[model samples]
Each structure stands twice: as C-alpha cells, then as structure tokens.
Target: MSAANRSGADNQPGVLVTGASGFVGRYLLRRLQTEPVTVSTLQRPRHDLLQPASLTELCQGVDTVYHLAAYAHVNQAQIKTLYATNVDGTINLLSAAVAAGVRRLVYVSSILADPAFDQPRTAYGEAKQRAESLLQAAHQAGDIEVVIVRPVNVYGVGMKGNLMTLLRLLRKGVMPPLPRFTQPFSLIGVEDLCQALVLAAQCSVGDNAPIYALTDGEHYDIKSLEQAMRTALGRSQPAWATPKAVFYLGALTLEIAGRLLPINNSPGLRSYHALARNYAVDDTASQRDLGYNPRSTFYCTLPAIISAMDAGSAGADTSDTDNTQ
Candidate 1:
C-alpha cells in the first residue's frame, strides 16, 4: 500500500482525510501530521465515490473518517452532477466506513443550508442538506457515530473562490464592489476548522449535541472588512459605500445573464447572497462543546492572509479556486 493509503490504518486511531487535495483538506492533512496520529488520505479512481468499486480496500482498517469531499461550488451548471457527487457520494462513504467498522465520521457541511434565505437557491445547498439528513438518520439509527460541523466562509492561503476574488480586488488597491449592508458574515480560518474537525471527532460530547456551527466567533461586517483590506494593502483608498439597490440590480442582471450563458467560474447573480443574508452563525455551541477557540479575528487574519499572499505572489505564480458555497 502507498504511504498515503495508510490513513485508514486498521483502526489504528488515526484520521482518514477525504478531499485531501482541496484547500481545507490540504490544511487539515498538514495539521494532522503535527499531532501524534496516523493520517491516511483516500486516493482517486477505485476509491472515488462515483466509482463502481466498493470502498473495501480503501477503508479496510480506518477508525475515523473526515469527509470533506463534495461539489463545493455553488454555481455549478450540472445540477445532476451536484446531487450525484454530494448525496450519492456521501452514502457511499458512510456505508463503506460502516463496513470498515470506523469509530467516528465527521461530515463537513456549509451554513448555506439555511433555507429561509431569499436568494436564488443553488444546487450546492440542496446537496449538502441531503447529505446532512442522511448522516443524521444513520447516526440516529445506530449505523454510524457521526458528527456534523457547518462552517461559514472558510478562508486560508492557496484557497479558491469568492475569497480569492476579494483578495485580488484588494491587492490592486480596490475594494470589492460590495453594497452597504449590515448582514453579518461568519468566517473561519482553515487551521481553526481543522482543529474543530479533530475536536468534534474525539470530544466527549453527547449525541444530542452533535451538530455544531463553526466560526471565528466574530461578526463579519462587510464595511469593516473593506477597511481592513485597505489597511492590509497599505492603500489609503477612500472608502465609499455603494447603494444596496445597485448591488441588487447588478446581481439580478447577472443572474438573468448567467441563465442565458455559461457562467462557469463565478456564480454571477449568486454573489448577491453574500450581500443579502445574515450569515452570522451562533458559535456558542462549538465553543462550549469542542473547545474551538479561534484567536484570529477578521481584522487580524486579513492582514496575515494578505501578507502571505503577497509573499507567495513574489516567490511564485499562484491561483485560488473560489467557492462560496
């Protein structure tokens, strides 16, 4: 067996990291290495959830599974692919882990599962909600020991999606064309999320308190974020607030345009959701249960992320694959 496949090591009390090549997964893999635990990653082809082969070989002796794989992008055009990967794929993982006698499973979900939001719903949210429901049912049925963590926008270096777009806008001494609004955004750093995952897997929390919302414990104010980005870039750009209607109209127009064309990379009109809803997650449960104390506030983390981006830009060419889901 390859060294990476050693993660689901015969109930060796280590972690099996799915989506290890993605942004948060990369950070999680690195963070797990610092701890006194064996780490294994699920490889592609035969182990892929969509693949026909069973997960027997890959999950043979794994004790715990950190499931981070899914169609993370909110604007993916192929609706069928989204459900296939997120829903069916989750079943595949859960069933295989059960067959392998895994002790615990950590399913990473997104806060966008909030159904009350008025924004045009995306398939990504539907997919995650389905996955959560399946896992919850399995846990209740005594089929799997499952823990669910719903995180807000996760930020980290070398990450992709809207976060990167905002960073690029700031790097050029410009703020994102965001409207003036008061909806609070909940965000978490990749490092802190990894910590939360491990804690959720190993903590002595009861089954009733399994679902926890992950955040940095600070309310995200877009206007404040604008100022922080400017400060980080060392630019004295005058901060002017755009009217909410402008943002609304622009988003509506894009939403219409996206339907008419192939809006692949950025989620055109879906960007409005970032400006429209209250994404502030009550992290009291996470703090009380998992001891997930994030010391990095938006202001502090922004500067550090900006500095790291600057250094990376100087050393080598880099790209961020953005996902706001």
Candidate 2:
C-alpha cells in the first residue's frame, strides 16, 4: 500500500478533472471552482487517454483525480476504440496516478456497468465494467484509494445523448406519442452527480474500495416523464398513443440500417432496451457513507434542459449522447 493513499496532504489537495469539456465534466468543474481545492483540467488533444504518453504527467502534484473522460456511445463497430479508451486508457491513468503518489481517484462509472442488467451487454457497458474491475484491482493493491460512482441516466442542462435526442424530437413535434412504458428507470441530475462525485472524493477512505450507485430517489415511468416534459415545453399531448409495434418496427428498421450502412447513434436493440428495460438502482450506501442527498429531479430540471436545447447551449451533434447510461 502506498503511504500517499492513507495520509492527508499538509495543504489543500490539488484536483485534476479529466473530460473537463464534457457535459457532466463541465458541471463538475463549475462545482469544483466553488470549493477550496485547487482545480486542474485536461485539454483533450493535449491530454488524451488513448495516447498513454500524454497521461504520464497528468496526475503529477495532484492529490485527487476525477476521471470522467469516457467514450460513451453504444455503437458495436467502435468496440475496439471503446476498449482502448475506457479500459486501456483507465489502466494508463491508474499507472500515472500511482506513480505520481496521488492519494485518491474518484471514477464516474455508469449503471450499465452492471452485467445483470443485460444478458449480453452493449460494448460501451462492457468497457465500463472492465474499467471498474481494473480500478478495483488497483485499489486492492493499495496503489490508490478508489471511489467509484455508478450513476444512472444523468440529465440536466447541456445534456446530450439518448435523452437529449428524445427532447429534440419532442420539441420538433416530429416524434409520435410514445406508448406508456410501466418499467421505471433511475436518473440523476448533472449537478447532483457532481455533488456525488465531490462527496466520493471527500469521504473517508476505507480498507476496501467503495462503489456508490446514485439517483435522485424518484420514481419515473416513460408515460409520466413524457407528460411532464410535454407540459413543461408547452407542447400538446398527443390525442392518441403510438402503438408499441410501431416503435418496435422503427427500431428494427434502424437496427437493420445500422448493420448495412455507416451510421452513428442508431436506435438499435441497445437503445430500445435502454428505454424499455427497468434499470432502477439502490443508493442507500451513498446516503449512509457519503451523505449523498440528491436535490434535482428530472421534473424540476426539465425547464433548464429545455432552455438549453432551445438556446443551443447543448450541441446538435449526434456523435455522443449516452443512450446506454
């Protein structure tokens, strides 16, 4: 075990945030700025995970690292790239952090990392699971204190990915009225996730690495969610519901098209399952250990998200949005 992993720094800890330009990362940075810690951010081209050489010095003089940089799409074609970045890149960062005598690393993992959710997980989920295992091994070896936070679907202002795509479609009125899906899912606001990350970093280090699953502690089904969003956006509720078969057919078409054509962000079986499946998580440990009490719900934060979408604060690019979150 490294002494650095056990002892406190004499001065305020230096914190480094990877993926500082990302949706959640941006929110985390803003939250960190309000704290007393010295904050450092990584620029992508200059400090990339795949380029292990670039990561060598990233953890130098940093007491804690917030690792949020991840390839967050579910395209199977990019499986190799996903593993390289999520799994191998994480190994690179672990090496750097250990060598730099960093004390702790707070990793932002996703709920999809749990293999129990799917019989055969998406490539992105597998990659995150692999990364989490590696981080756990490092922690076991006493290389660093590891705190892993597995957040369910995260939504907030400047949010992108599957949820954002849905919001865009809804705003355009091109999306048909969705069928009521009774399967409930969990979600965390970006700000709440940021708070959870900070709590993970600040909480006492234990003999074993701790993994915290986070959500806003609210129940949300697709029908109620759609109603809330529609009401908030001033969009009319559809007079009739679109049949489930219609959506299934659309997903099947997209799946076949994805297999035949070069497409990104296609709504295939993975996205379909993500929306339709029940993926609720228990965050009792987060509450007990880190005092994690989430304040924002999807209902409360819908306005900010709608406002961001309308004002173009969120990007229109389909390259990245975490549908598999």
Candidate 3:
C-alpha cells in the first residue's frame, strides 16, 4: 500500500490498482512505479470489492482506477462465487468509485467477454462480460470515463492457466506430443499488457467508451507453440503426434475425476476447445488509438516462462494461477 500526495504544488494524479497481487496486476504495479503517478493498492479484506464501504475509502483522491480483481476460475462449480465476485463485486466497486469522484477507470477485461468467440462461454467469461456492461453503462451516464481492454491469452514469466499446465506436463515427460493444429491463437505478454493498460489509462475515449483488444501481433498454432515450449525446456521433439481422441479421452477422465473428488479447474471440453480453436484477436484499434506496440512474442517469452517454472514460481497465488481453471 503506497500513499498519495494529499497536497502538493503539482498534485500528481493518484492511481489505485484493484488486483495488485494477481499475475497481470503484479507486472502492472512494477510498470506504474516508473511512471509519474502516485500508486495505491487494495488492502485485501479492508478494501475488498464486496465491502463497498472499504472501496469508497480506498477510492478517495484517486484519479484513475485499474479494476483487475475478479473471480477468474473457469470451473462451473464456482459459478455462484464467480458471479458474486466478478459481477456483483464490480457493481459495488463502480458505485464506490463514482461516489468517491474517481475520474477514470481502466478495466482489464478478457477476450472471452466478446460474444464473437465461438467457444461456449465459461462462468468466468460470463462474469467478466456482465461486469463490462455495468462499467459501460456507468461511462455512458457520465459517471466516469471508462477504457475497457480485452486482452488475448496473456503469457509471461510466472504465468499460470493452460500454458502452465502444459509446461508442467512437458517437464514431467509424461505428456503426449501435440497434434498438428493450424488454428491461430493470440497471446500477449504480461509486460506488454501492462504497457497497453497504462496507455489505455492515458488515452482519451469517446462518449461510447472504446473497447480495445490487445495481442502480441504474432501468429501461433498449437504445434508451433508446443515445439517452442519443448525447445525452451530442453526437451526433444516427439516423432509421433498423439491423436485428438486420446487428448479428449484424457480430458474426460480428468473431468469425471474432478466431479468425484475436490479437483478445481479440471481439463474438460473447455480445455480441448481452447487448445484446438482459433482464439485470435484484432488489435488495429488498440494500435491506432492507444499507440500500443507489443514488444514480446510467445516465442520470445518462452525462455522466461520456462525459467520461472523451473524455479517453482508457476503455481503461486498470482492472477493467472488463482484463475487457472
């Protein structure tokens, strides 16, 4: 928790970060330190979104708010908790921000929020979508200026989620080789995402409150991505590719096991869909509007991710890890 200058000849703009302890939030905090703005972090139980009174106190004197905290678990079992935290929590936080006179809110939304995605919506995605609508409504009503950023699959050092699962399996040498899937998948490095977030905070928006999709501007297929990870991990490429049926069967077993036991975030059809589908994004608006130029590609960042995983930092309680389901 950092303090803002209450009174100064030139009042440095006050910035508050909601998910200060999450994956992207951690990188964002580091990025903000280099900027001129004074930064403040949410104090957990004291500043929880569900607790509106705490949020109101936290937002006082804050000019910009980065709303990153949310229940990101993709498991269906957590649907009730997801809505309570992601949707209702967002509503509570938005009200507090408005009441406290916060000038702008830069929301780190997910690409899943776009209804255009072909895959079935996860509980996590629906929650994010609902929260985005509330923020848009607030912006339209002139309560606060809003900039919504829908980031593609974010990857970097210490990243969790699907990629982390893949890495761990690959490290153990028990994972089968991936099939040749040509569908493109878009990914943005965490550092690049943080840069785009800061840029979003500074850029002006229209009355409609523009939404930006961010990517690393690199095209990747399942095979290429897996090969790159294997290379980074110093593993030899498998001569044979595992059939899609085997992958699906394994996922189904995990799904059943998850239901029977206490497994959260079991690999099921959703994981298969994510792995096989073309979950790409267009960042032309982001480039034109916010001057967002992503510098790191998945191929380039694999070494760092491998390094972090080797050091046993992958499954930490960061943003991606917390919502890895």
Candidate 4:
C-alpha cells in the first residue's frame, strides 16, 4: 500500500489504522479515501506477531488512531493470545497515542461488550469486554478521546467469518441445521460499518461522552434469515432445527476435539450461542450522533450476493461450450 500525503491545510486529519489487513479494515481503508483524509496502515511483520513499538512510531503526529487489530480467534487455547493482542496491544497503542498527543482513539469493539451475553463464560466475548474496560479507563483518566464502536454480525463480500461458511454451504446445496433462535439479530454491511468508523473518527460532538452500538435497520431471526438465503439462491432445501442442548453438546465436543485434533475453531459456534440467547442492540445513538446510516438489510443484500454467485456458476458451466459442430 502506497502512502498518499496531504497538505496541512486540508483540514482532514492524518489517520492511522491497525488491523489493516482484516475484513473490516479493508472496507474502512477504502471508505476513508472519500473523506479526503490522509491514511496510513499498520501491519505486523511476518515473523513478529506483536509490534507495539512499531505501532507507537506510526501514531506520531497522527490526529486519530483506529485500533482494529486483535487475535480474534474465540476458543480456550487462544485465550492467552487473544488477551495479549486485544488487551495488551490496546494498552500499548493507547499509551503511544497519549504520548504522541493523538486527538482521538476510535476503538472498533464488538457487540460482545453489550452485557447481553454471559461474557465470563465465553472466552472471546470476555476478552473484548476486558479491552473495552481498558479503553474506558483510559478515557476516564483523560488519556485520550476514546470512542468505542460495537458492531454486530458484519457480513459482505470477501467475508471470512461464519456468514461466509453458511454461504458456502448454501452454494453446495447443504442447508445448515440451525438453532431455533427467535432473537432480533442486527447486522451492518461492511461498507456501512466503514462509514460509521470514519464518522466516529471525525466526530467532536461528544468528547467521548457516548459509546455507540452500530447495526443495520433490519433484524432477523435465524429461521427467517435462512429462508431469505434459500429464496436468494432460488433453491429448496430442508433445514433441521437442532435442539439447543444437542447443539451445545456438539460444540463442546468439537471444542474439545479441536484442541487434540488439528481442527480449526469455528466462530459460528460462538455466534450461535450468542444468537440462541438474543444479541440485538440499539443503534439509534450511533445514527444520531455519528451520522451512522446503515445500508440495505440482509433481505436486500443476500439476494444480490446469491444472484452474483449463481451468475458466476452459470458462466463457469458454459465456459467450455463448443462452436466447432
């Protein structure tokens, strides 16, 4: 990534972004350009997983620093790593920002900090909450303008999370057996989330007075969301509503086996637990304060994604068509 410099008279601030390679980071980086702000990214070195010193130097003279980097794997074994990256790393970054006289520290937290879940029981949620507390403490002590933004169940193109796995299953015509969750779950497109972040970075209304929870306008239950996906794909598939007890048992078994075996941890399981108990948020504050207007809902966007996937599959099928008859 090339650095694009701006004159001091431009009025836009120099912004530093951590987790520049992550799903949300990519969108935020692209969206920041439209605001005509000077953007710089921080990436960990190939061998060095932790780079607090490097982050410090990067924040020097920057007006706002957006901390998005974290060891996001949500499992028991990954607990230490998550704390190191999400908690310790945040502390390091905040210390550096304060030293460098950075104006604002916009933290991209998760909805897991909502207290809606028993965060103590979940490793990932607990880590996020811890990080939030650290930032809030820093804010209270007058270290920096720490603005926390909590987003729920973000999904879009190039998404590498649970939603992508579900989409992949749909592509393969396998309707995933889901839990019978009747909660009004919220979501925001990656694009809209980026917009909110930029607005948060530039906002001077609160002086860290409020912590915002962000979401798209529409909320859907698991059953309805699955049906929407099926309708989008124009396919009919049977989906089983696995009992919650059975589902948790399977997740527990997998969690145990994932340690002994070489299986990758599934964020889907954690998300399922969160949804099974309802994880909705009130984003009205973000909308009013940060000018955060969510884009199209799952019902609107899922169809487009499915239609594009279908078109791609159809094109691939006809790629070998012969005209030499």
Candidate 5:
C-alpha cells in the first residue's frame, strides 16, 4: 500500500494542532502537511492558543488533537499564567474534544512532571501534572484515546530554553563555570519530538495511555552539552566547574536579585537544579512500542540550530547582538 493509504484515516478523522505558532508546533505543522489527513491549527492573537469557539469547531471531525499550547516559561510572575494556559486551557480543549468525539488526544507534557525534582517548585511541571491527571480521568471515563508525551530538555532550532541561553552566551564568548551538573540530562531534537507526537496521534497499540517519557537514546552531562555548544560555535573557551556550594550560592544570589530587579529569567539556574539531580529516563518502552526514535544528538543538531538562527538574523540584516540579550 502507498504511504497515504497506510496512514490515512479515510477522512473520518482530521488533525488539529494547538499552539501552532510554537517551536515544536512549527515543525509538527510542517510534518503534518505531508500526511494525508486534513490539518487545522489553533493559535491566539497574543498568546494565540485559538479561541474557544474556533477550538470547538476544529475539534469537530478531528480524530487527533495535539495539545502543545502552554505557558512554557518558569518564572515567578509566570506561575499563574502557566496554570491558566497549561491547566485551564487544556481542560477547555479536552472538553471540546470530548464533545466533538475526537478519537485521540496527544498532550505534550514535560518530564518535570516526574516528581523527582521536589525542591525549587516547578510551576510548569505542576500544571502539566494536573493536566495529565485530568486527561487520565477523562480516559477512565472513556472520553477519548489520550497519550501524554513527556519530553525532556527539548532543544534544537527555534528552541527557547536554558540551552539556548548557553548557546547565546557561547556565541558571545562568555563561558560560565557550571557545577552541580553531574546528572545525566536527556535531550530530544525538535524533529524527533514532532515525530513522536505524530506517532502518538496515530498509534493504535494502546488505548488511552496516560504517560510516555520521550528522550534521545543517549544522555549527556552538562560539560558535554557545553562542549557541544562550543564546538558548534567553533569557539574554544576554558570553563572551570565551580564547586556545587559556590554555584548554588551564586545562583541563589542571582535568583534573589532577579526577584527584586527586572532581569530576564535564567533557565541556567533551574537547569543546574535539574541536572544536579538524576533525570535520565529509559525511552526503550517508547522505542519498542511506539517506534519513537530521536533523530539527532545535541552535538549534531546544535550547529544546525545556530546556523539557522544566524542565517535568519543575517537575512533580516539584524545584528545577533541585539537578539541574544
């Protein structure tokens, strides 16, 4: 059979993507267009997660709903906003999907929901966990086929996270000594994450599975990620690993200062906290069951991301200096 016939749902189920303007959403959209299913997107004007009426309409006749919209930032002021988007918005969308009789729902959650990181309080993770719980309840009620994808440290082109900040710093030749980085960190390329989302939407092997932790096959330490960034940028800078106590003290100072002053929230400190603890997940289940495979490594993919960012910045005749800060 042809690819179209093999994957097609015979027009009985269409696909709807939320957060269509996000980094992952962009890649997912590109991939979905190649599929035979009908595609619809929901985005807000400012936050752009689609209005309720539009969302309801899109949910109608949609077999799969990929819910990727969320307030992704982890800052003090963003806590409430995160709950509003990640929890409330998810409930709204899932409710609509239920009403529309959507066949499957793919929720993009974070590995922070693992409950391993107890201290420092991850608002994003809390909201995601709550949403997952809600979805689980719905699944129990037989409302729809729900698959929750918990991706870890997703980084690649168009990714805005701690790793991106490090890349920006590296490009500017500022290498900070990182400590408390012994934990094995997992990463998933944007493309691989998109593929997993697609597979989760289409897979019929399980019914309403609540959770899947998606990651690249291998894990890397903080030093390795930093070195990858350095290699990607073709910059050779000496970086010393500070003592964990000193690093935590500096991070605490910076965190306090950020709270008091207007500072762009740093993911570095949060990442330090994350990497200070073990976060390695076995994606073997996902690989064996859903055929989910990560395509690229941080070492291979970071350069392409940097190159694309550079090309875009150059094409627009915009200085990278302005965009980095």
Candidate 6:
C-alpha cells in the first residue's frame, strides 16, 4: 500500500476529483471547498481519463481520488466507448494513483452493477461492474485503501435520464397509472452522497475490509412513489394503476420508434427492467462504516430537480440535455 495518512490536517489530504465538471462532481467539489483539504480537479486540457498520459500529473500529490468519470450511456450502441472509458480508464487511473503513492480511493460505482436485475445486464452496467472488479483487485493486492460505493437512483439539481423523464410524464398529467409492485426504489441526493464521500475519505483505513457500501434510506414503492411525488409536486391529477402489459406495450412501441426516427428520447428496455427489480440498496453498512445518513427523500428533492429541468429545457437545444445519467 502507498504511504499516506488519511487523518492529517497539517499535511492535509490532497483530494483529486475526476469528472469535476459533471453533475455529481460539481456538488462534490463544492462540498470539498468547505473543508480544510487541498483540492484538485482532473478535468479538461491538463487531465482526462480518456487521455491516460494526463493521469500521472493529476495523481501527483493527491492522497485520495474520488473517481466519478465513466461513460454512463444506456444505449447498447455505445458499448465499446463505455468499456474504453469505464473499464480501461479505471485501470489507467488506478495505476497512476499507485505510482503516485496515493493512500485511498473512493470509487463512484452504480447499483446497476448487479447482474440480478429482471433484464439482461446493460453494457453500461457491465462496464461499471468490470471497473469495480479491477479496483477491488488492486485493493486486494494492497495497492491502496478502496472504498467502493454503489448508489441507487441518484437524483438532485441538474439531474437527467430516467428519473427526470418520469417526473416530466407526471407533470404533464400523463403519468401512467402507478405500477402494482410493492418493491421499493431507493435514491440518494447529490448533497447526501457528497457527505458520504467525505466520510469515506476521512475514515480510518485498516486490514479489516475493502469498504463496499450502498446509498439508500427511503422505502417508496412504485405505487407510493407516484402518489408521494404527485403530492410533493402539488399535482391534482389522480394517477391510476395499470397492468404490466400496458407498460410493456408502451416500451416496445417507443423502442421501435427510436430506431425508426431521429429521436433519442426513448427510455429503452433497461428502464422498464429497472422499475421491476425492486431497486433499493441496503445502507446499513454504509451508515456503520461511514457516517452516511442520507437526508433527501424522493418526495423532498423534486422541487430542485424540477427547477433544474425547467432551466435546462428553456435555454438549450435537445443535444445539451442529452446525458445518459
């Protein structure tokens, strides 16, 4: 393992945040600035995961790295790009961190890394899973202290992808009847995730374990999810519960349309499969290992997310909001 202490303020930990300009990265950077730590961003001209040559310079003097850079695209067509960025890039960054004598790494992995979902795993999820395996191997070899976190349905200001799409449908009074499933969907706000990450970076490292954790706190089932969100958003339209056939038909139609048209707004098969998996993570270990108490629930954070959606939709073309996160 690299020689460095996590709890020293005199020689404070030099934290490096990859994907610093991204949605969650921006929140993390903001939170880091409030602490007595040295901060650096692995962004743009000087540093990039795609450009492996840039990694050494970014890793220099950095004691802890918050790796959030990954190709988050859900489209199967981007599989090659996803593997190149998510898997290979992590290998390159891990190598760089080891060479730089970094102590610990807090990797921003996804809950979808599991292959136990209702549908065949996505290329995006597969890529993230491969990346986690690589990081875990390095930890097992004593390269660094690894804290791998799998977050479920991360939502906050400036969020996009499936959650926002569902919210939009609800706002337009076209939200399909809530599904009858009783399985819960967990979520973590950007702010809450940032706090957990800080805790991960500060916690004492030992030969105890690799520190694998998930982020989740609420228990909003699909049926109650719609009701809670509608109430929170002050929607007057009462949502109905439809059969699985209705959703399947709608998803298939949209999938077919996406292939035919130039539209890229389709949610694809993975979105349908995701809602059926009882998608919530167990946060007990996270709460015990790191002082992670996620404060935002699905119902509470909707206002910020809606405002962000409005701001994003009003100013830019569709291409600007074309994120897969």
lDDT of 1 by residue, 1-325 (tens): 4645663334347678888777787778888877666787877764787763546666666678888887654334667877898889889888888888888889887776655431466677767778889998888877778898888777766655666677688778555446776788777887888899889888874554278888888888776677667667777756576778877787688777767766654455556776666767788988998888886665666766777787874122121111364
Best by lDDT: 3
RMSD of each: 3.1, 4.5, 2.6, 7.8, 5.7, 5.0
| lDDT score at residue 61, model 6, on the 0-100 scale | 83
TM of each candidate vs. truth: 0.89, 0.91, 0.92, 0.83, 0.86, 0.85
Provide the overall lDDT of each model, using Cα atoms, as 2-decimal numbers. Answer: 0.72, 0.78, 0.80, 0.67, 0.70, 0.71
State the displacement of the C-alpha of residue 211, model 3, in Å, after optimal TM-score superposition: 1.0
lDDT of 6 by residue, 1-325 (tens): 1222122254767888877667777778789888888787765655667777778877888888998877664344555777888889899999999999999999888776767632555666677788888888888789888888777666677776666666778878887665676766677777888898888887866653244445557766766766766766678645457888788777788777755665544565556666676666678978987867777776777776677666764122111111332
Candidate with best TM-score: 3
Off by over 4 Å in 2: 1-11, 118-120, 315-324
Tens digits of per-residue lDDT for model 4 on 53-165? 66556776689888877666444556677778777777888887898999888888777665664432555556778878888887777878888888877766555555656
- Model 4 CA deviation exceeding 4 Å by range: 1-12, 46-49, 118-120, 176-180, 205-209, 237-249, 259-262, 267-272, 307-325
lDDT comparison, 4 vs 5, better candidate:
5
Pick by lDDT: 1 or 5, better one: 1
List model 2 lDDT by residue over 1-325, tens digit each. Answer: 1212212333667888887777787777789878877777766577777777887666777988999888766454776887888889889988988999999999988877888664346777778888899999889889899999888888887776667777778888887888767788888888888889999998986667888888898868877888887788889998798787887788789988987776765667665675687767788989899998899999888888888777877643322224244
Which pairs clash (backbone N, Cα, C closer than 3 Å) in model 2?
161-321
Clashes of each: 7, 1, 2, 0, 4, 1
- Model 1's lDDT to the true fold? 0.72
- Please tell me which model should have the higher TM-score, number 2 or number 3: 3
